[model samples]
Target chain A: MGETRLMKGNEAIAEAAIRAGCDAYFGYPITPQSEIIEYLASQEPHKRTGMVLLQAESELGAINMVYGAAGTGKKAMTSSSSPGISLMQEGLSYMAGSELPCLVVNIVRGGPGLGTIQPSQADYFQATKGGGHGDYKLIVLAPASVQEMSDFVPLAFDLAFKYRNPVMILSDGVIGQMMEKVELFDQMPRATEFDQTWVTTGKTADRERNIHSSLDLDPARFEKHNHHLQEKYKKIIENEVRFEKIQCDDADYVLVAYGSSSRICQKTQKLAREKGIKAGLLRPITLFPFPYEEIEKLANHVKGFLAVELSAGQMVEDVELAVGKKTRIEFYGRIGGMIPTPTEILTVLEEKYLGG
Target chain B: MNEEIIIAGFGGQGILSMGSILSYSGIIENREVSWMPSYGPEMRGGTANVTVILSSERISSPIINTYDTAILLNQQSLDKFENSVRPGGLLLYDTNGITRHPERTDISIYQVEAAAEAGKMASTKTFNMIVLGAYLKIKPLVKFENVITGLKKTLPERHHHLIPLNEEGLKRGMEIVKEVQLG
Candidate 1:
């Protein structure tokens, strides 16, 4: 722990990976999240600590490199924004099917196509519901600030390795581009505390082992393998669901927002108080687990709820499932890289609560 | 409980200082805050914007789409962000550059001749200070003592000699605010 120094979100994630004993980094450059690659490029990891850093020809190659490095029980990571992340889905699915542990990051940009340079949470379903083919789930952590971006990378690695599954640090353009204070620590002196019994790190003198591809000729065996994976996912859901609540006590009309949209919710809370409207915000830091229980609790007290997002209607589906139509739950958003102004949000609230 | 703000302008004006003082006041009050600028190709005489977020709680997102309050140092920024002002929000503008009011009736406009006031003080380029003074008078998010303390803390070790003059500029700018108001 040291004095906080200003760093961009992408840079902080890179530093956190180094601290978490991530010896291998394979990535391709993309907007918003480019600083991670830039920071890794500037560091002398090879000379100082034997960390391997490589920029691959494409996102697919980078992901495959992560697969190779993780196979050796080495902490490895690769990062890209939305479109680039889409290209790596095939590799991610393969990694998941093979039960490989590694970290991947998608600093989300406006998307569906190439989109724009601005931020968007449109990739929520893709990340949480599994964008790739076949039944698989990746543990996804959505960071709301640059500090989280830096601090959570090591944690992401810890979870990825602990569960023997892939984990993702889902961020956006705002978190990547903005600079804030972060603390960095030296790399762990002795690594590999987690289980390495399954790793095929060159056959030892006593025994030999082989790593399998995502293939099985026997139907019963493959079904058993997938069933085991589903059990692991069930454990993740039971144990890990993270969210932040503010002034929700005895409040009506709770506002559900995340990432950049959460900032406006904070301001809206302040303004709502001044205008004598009772409102609060529920911000989800971990988007995958979805924080269903917390939203369910708020449904009891609030008369209505608002799902504010950068996209037209994405996370609203999850909210609907959680609330289950007990009250009036509406949504307000701005798509195509346009951000919703606080005033527009306030207008929505006033119309629903105070009557126009 | 202080509010963080970012006022941006053209290259010649004191755009950075507006954000600097707001952040400085937050520091003096022992509040968490930051002032980030648009640099690189964007800062090269083109349109520039800054994002500032201040709160008692941990600030999740620092990106600013609409300012809680804005002090526009030039006409270009005004044209860019006038509609962004919340209904019943404040827009502090330089009357020197903008001869007209913003076309929105929902926001309160406070226009001032910032360049003229700074010029009269022989601090020709310190229009940012003049804008800050005006901001203090109308908004009052930070105290004068805290603002001064933040200014001192911000003074570089090499530029300690310039602190007194900067204080004078800040005080005069705050004083100049009383001369202009919109009803």
Candidate 2:
């Protein structure tokens, strides 16, 4: 524990990035998430830790800047909301193809297009199923609280570098704008020594020249590279599945949710338990990994599962797949930036699972 | 004890700040606290609202439709949130802008002339502080000293001079607030 401070989620992310020894931050200002870049700019990280903080003209420019810096083995990151993230998908795909390690924070807002700036979890498929064009995947971490927002920055960087892949922090307007007390971590100096064998930092006399490009042109080479990427993804799936189970051991029903929706589901579970419903919450901390095995195990004991989200229905598809024909999986959500209240979720649980 | 509160008013009325101060006070008392503000276009000048939850144990959700307490500053807020107060909960409102008083029979209602009182004060910025003061008087959820410490944490150092004035406003609010007796 470094220091306990009452801060907004976006501010926590910015401060966490600095403490995580991030080498550079490049991002455009967007509502519900602009505070991240604003706080970073105000801190003058460039002055404090010699970190580079640049405000890109657009989300595209910011993501491409991340790509450029990450290609050189620097801990670089960029943040954006829904529409802006959509704009960065091309860059994200390119980064994934080049196998560059970088962090992308999506403080998601409601959207098929330029939707409302309020919170929404509609980007589940966009994030977990590869928003960008490719067979590549980003290690997506869903942070539910300001503390998680702070903690995930460093965790994301570590995982990104370990796998040599792009990682995304899938948050939303609620988590971005809400304020809560968070225990921050002590400052860690920028990583000075890491494997730079694949970095494009100019060739030395003794080392072979390195190239960072997504295009192989040769079909055979590209196919082999895709296979290698698939192998890495398989390893991540086996080891990186992270989920939290609250009162799940003897639960009759389970509530599956992520990010902000998980917070509401926790309350719903408590309410249900008070009413002798034997409810539990299964919160997937990592959306990309999906925590399929955990849900499958829970399905054996629970009567049903409710996949709650801030969107109409996205993650529920994955839950259904995990539960298979063994148990019923239902979805309850509110769209267009509307957040479902705890009572609403509880009412849904009562109606759908409690046979009320 | 867990208190789920909603503070609502005109965007510039400092409703969000009041919620922030209350949440900070909870933190000062080592309670789990969350303060969530209404974001986006409605916050520009329309009715702005914030949901604040303070609990002895970990807080589950900050988004709530019903509240244990409601601090309403404007008529719009009063109209919107008067019914949102749970039965036996408290509804605190400023009489300055409300045309219709809260009609809830099951909940406790209190009135404070914070806006008119702020008009008499040196600065109108202490308006929310006065209402907060009344809230503390009714519930006394956290210690008054904790609120002072919370103010120190929430307000920047340069704004420290206004703390004394805000405290004065809070004291005044506590003195003047009156509960509406039901028939």
Candidate 3:
């Protein structure tokens, strides 16, 4: 343990960014997540680490700022709610196509339009399925607790640069606003030493001019770029999938959930087990490189799967793809900022699976 | 022991700060703790509440609908969360302007005149502290010394001067809280 403190998930992430030696953070203020920028401003990171913190005019301005900084191989990140993230889709697509590294955080609120300012998992498809045009994928990390909010900043940045793609920290309002005990890490020195070989640092006399662009005028060249991106995603999929399994050793029913819903499902597991239902929890820390293999393995023993979320049903579709028809699968959800009760989830499980 | 508590009232009632202080106290005691507030725009008008859970073990859900204890501060909050208290659990409240008190026969009900008590000494800003004192007196979930540390931790450096007043309000609250009788 480094230094223990009780902090809101949003504030914890900002403090983590400073500790991680992040170079710049460009974001606007939004409810449930404004604390991220607020905490950053309060600490005056520009004075502490020489980190640049800016309030761009709009979400569009903020993300493009991230795009420009990341082009030079500098660590850059932006955070916003659902609508703000939606606006950044175009920038995310370009970052993916250009093979640039950056971090984007979506402290998701309920949405299709300007929906309620409640927590939601409806952004699953947008994050994992390439919300923007063209075929590309972002490495999405879903944090369920306030502690994970702090821990994931450095991890997200690492994965982003390692893969040369944007990394999205997908969380909901619950995790964003809640307070919990967190052990903040010691400060790491800001990244200074760089090869400056592939990315554009400066065109010196020693090296040839480096070109970076998502636009390939020739169809054949664009197709080649797509192939390269697909290969990268394939490698990431093979190596980067992360998840957690609880009580699965003796499970009869498995609950598949991510982020805050997973925490709720954990309670559902306890209540179900006490009632002799033999329940378990599978929490996917990485929502993009989902825990498909793990769920398929559990299908061999469990009676069925319950996909719990704060949306009507989005991640459930992914669950269907993983288990196929190996076992019965059901969905339980609440939307528009409404969080489901653990007892209600258990009741839904009984009615869907155990009821005759 | 796992103590899942819900504190509910309006904004400016120190509703959020009370939770911050209590949950930070859990940190001083080196226990697993979480504080989740009804932090949406809905809090601007109606009741605002925060769920605080302190446990020896890991906490599962921070968005639970029910709690081991419900500390309500007004008529609207009592109406909203009267049934949220667990059977055989504690339902402590302030009977300041309460038109409808808790009627649950299965739970223990206690009332504190926090508004008047706080007004007697200073502003109603200390109202929430008085209620916190009363609850701690009944439950003693967090040690009093640790609570003082919690107050110190949650309050900013500029507010260090007010710790003694809040401490006094806590002691007064402990003295004035009365157990309610159910007919």
Identify the leading candidate in terms of DockQ: 3
lDDT of each: 0.77, 0.91, 0.91
Clashes of 2: 0
Q: Which ten residues in a row have the lowest lDDT in candidate 1 chain A?
A: A181-190
Task: Put down candidate 1 lDDT per residue, A110-180, tens digits, no spaces.
Answer: 88899886778888888989989989999999887767887788878888888888898887776777665
The root-mean-square deviation over C-alpha atoms between each candidate and the true structure, in angstroms, is 5.1, 1.3, 1.3
Per-residue lDDT for A347 in model 3? 91
Shift in Å, residue A340, candidate 1: 1.5
Model 1 is docked with a DockQ of: 0.21
Q: Candidate 3 — what's its lDDT?
A: 0.91
DockQ list for all candidates: 0.21, 0.88, 0.89
**Which prediction has more favorable lDDT, 1 or 2?**
2
lDDT of 1 by residue, B25-53 (tens): 76555566755565432434766667665
lDDT of model 2 at residue A273?
Answer: 90
| Lowest lDDT block of 10, candidate 3 chain B | B40-49
Which portions of model 2 show Cα errors greater than 4 Å?
A: A192-194, B41-43
